[model samples]
Target: MADNIYVVGHKSPDTDSVTSAITYANLKNQLGMKDVVPAAAGEINNETKYVLEYFKIAPPVVLNDATDKKVILVDHNEVGQAVDNIMKADILEIIDHHKIGDIQTGKPIFFHNEPVGATGTIIASMYELNGVAISKEMAGLMMAAILSDTVLFKSPTCTDKDKATVEKLSKICGEDPQKFGMEMLKAKSDIKSKTAKDILFGDFKKFDFSGVKAGVGQIEVMDLADLAPKREEILAEMRKALESEKLDMIVLMLTDVIKEASDLLFVGTAAAKEGFEKAFGGKVTNNSIYKEKVLSRKKQVIPPLESAFKK
Candidate 1:
């Protein structure tokens, strides 16, 4: 039994993934679990970087592979979303909010999967349950995760518990949720600084359905116009990704969080294109489709796409 345990999140680490690992690792250390170290499986995105800098919290060390380490996973469970060598590691526990996938453990572990918008929501309750006081900085980090994942409480994945947890976290951090959320989101909208490949892989995930491979990437912005200039560049990169990864489809969702709409750009097989049409009932014009009231990628995008692929 190794004394050290690594707390890490899924690959293509989002704010919720990074922050939940940090917060949970802190909770574990406070509860007398020594040598609990927080780690990230991928580079932190712009939004997560902004949150860490604002709170003056150091970013977690990047763990490229799990190897023989004892680990706890946060924000995601699928092996595809996990770090390289994750299947070979000793998975001690998992705390996630998404649907479970093909992760098999050697033995029973502490698994907490919930239907909330963010993994941070579940971790916040854990802090209260274990009587661990959340520091102001931790609360702020958790607040950022909640707002980012829920898209300022506008996404369909948001629950009453998510809202209430964010309210308490806001007060703890001495900030207004709407104001802080807007600032955080605006930080991510500076896509002009990143290359097309960077933008495409920033928050990307790969899924497999009956041997059909789909890669979906999402970028949340205040306005879709910001992406218009780089549309061609992004599409080229997506095509390159589809071919390199041998994916049946590659979809990039340009989500306008304020408007609660998504303009999707895709390059894929005819079956994949047909799946999109059947899923949203919107025509893909010039390689894109504008879908209103589409925010959560987990709920609105993946599920519908999966269902359509099955047909």
Candidate 2:
């Protein structure tokens, strides 16, 4: 077991993060890497839970710390978003679909980063590139990740490659992508049992933009009505979190998958507020703003905020 290597994804694990770790680990095993185990940085969210149940697979172990372990990262590369104490681990490989981040290593490792809709899309392709067969379970998980990340191919981040990969996985999994994707999305939309903090931090991520720290989270639902009444309650938690986390800003995106839009609720310092305003040309009313066609936090939200804050 000394050769055991854990495959893990970013904190506040979403479907893409959780499923990508699992599928990538499976790929590693099929390629004769026997000791590769999949792990999650936090509790699996509801949407991911549904996928695991549908696939009849157990969720990955929640591993917060990786000190003295051999690990491969998926879904994210930023140290701030990674598992705790990741810097202490012996980094072996990274398979991600996000921007290259500040994770430095003692030695060069296999780093694969693509600008695809989901990490699972890249991993699914890896299975083909390696001539390894993806099992039905693995294909289902990959399909779920792609659908979740791409918002059923409605997100601006979705590409031709992502669509093609989903088509391939759909056939392998023997599930209709449209029908199955709605079921998974409906699972994600069910947040009645979650507290305001739970809803806020479910998919949260932390970032540092030129020394200014900010936290951004997103929750995609079929309708915004379910969250309308809790808007004030959620904002209260965001305000508290902004203070407690010592963040310059906190932004939560309430995305309506059906509407293909997002409503942003934010709490921030003066500088952060200025940057936020500059990032998106809109008037902030009552700590919230409606943004049409803003479905992707990574491609649409973070880039402008990063650029706005850098100056």
Candidate 3:
């Protein structure tokens, strides 16, 4: 059960999702926004783990409530993850740097779901807007998240706004963005002690789209070479994940930062296949994307489905 006002990130969280939730929850509590708690639906990847360890922070509490009420959702706007518990509370506010989804919030509420590089960037802006002092730890988390999500600003998903926000936050954090980028990606890449199941479902969720069921997961890596190498492992695990969650369809987004295009992995039901095909005119071959682009569930994946589902 969540506290008075819980703070949760999106399913399959990235550095921005996890770190921003923690930092934002910390700030809200400091400002007397009582009963604030930071939680994540996914496990911390190696890169995010390093950032937390560097700041001596722990992972946010694990939460998988698909119907969250009166909570703040960071990094993602998919209805499945955000709505679990939405009726119980009210979805009071949303602060994200992702493309908007079917957000269910009370009227006259504050929502900041931008197409920026990182939720941390949006959080940074909030601190600046509210004249809240940015702690060094919070600044560091935001800086790292910005670098990771933007591919050091080489990502097609990045906008000039993302750079400006990161630059300002970096100055506050005293981190060299370029240096940190290399280090962070390297940390995320060398995954030696993890199982394929742990690796895949470590940060996973089941999405019930009214009647159509779908699942989405986020994977961040510095190199694309490992993707083909890990292809078989990913496929088998995704099949298991679909069965375990009992989802009608599951889409595994193998987003390679280096390659850009996400290798979209599809499993189960014809409806999802047709739904995704109508959204993106990409040829499907055992759930793989030929042209690799920066695959962001927030920016690319969820938006199309939102439009398609309405039809």
- Name the top TM-score candidate: 2
- In candidate 3, what are the lDDT values of residues 177-226, reduced to their tens digit? 88888888788766456566655765565555547777877565656566
Question: Predictions ranked by lDDT, top down?
Answer: 2, 1, 3
| TM-score of each candidate structure, all chains considered together | 0.97, 0.98, 0.83
Each prediction's Cα lDDT score?
0.91, 0.92, 0.73
lDDT (tens digit, per residue) of candidate 1 on 1-311: 35578899988899999999999999999999979989999889999999999999999998997989899999988988899999999999999999878899979999999999999999999999999999999999899999999999999999999999999999999989999999999888888798999889999998986567989899988888888889999999999999998999988999998788999888999988888788888888999888999898899888888788783
Tell me the lDDT of candidate 1.
Answer: 0.91
Judge candidate 2 at residue 257 and give its lDDT.
Answer: 94
Clashes of each: 0, 0, 17
Candidate 2's displacement at residue 222, Å, is 1.1
| Residue 238 of model 1, lDDT score | 96
Give the deviation of candidate 2 from the true structure as CA RMSD. 0.9
Q: List model 2 lDDT by residue over 1-311, tens digit each.
A: 45789999999999999998889889989889889999999999999999999999999988878889899999999999999899999999999988889999999899999998999899998999999998999999999999999999999889999999999999999999999999999999998888899899999999999899999999988899999889999999999998898999999999999999999888998888888888988768889788999999999999999999885
Model 1 alpha-carbon miss at residue 143, Å: 0.9
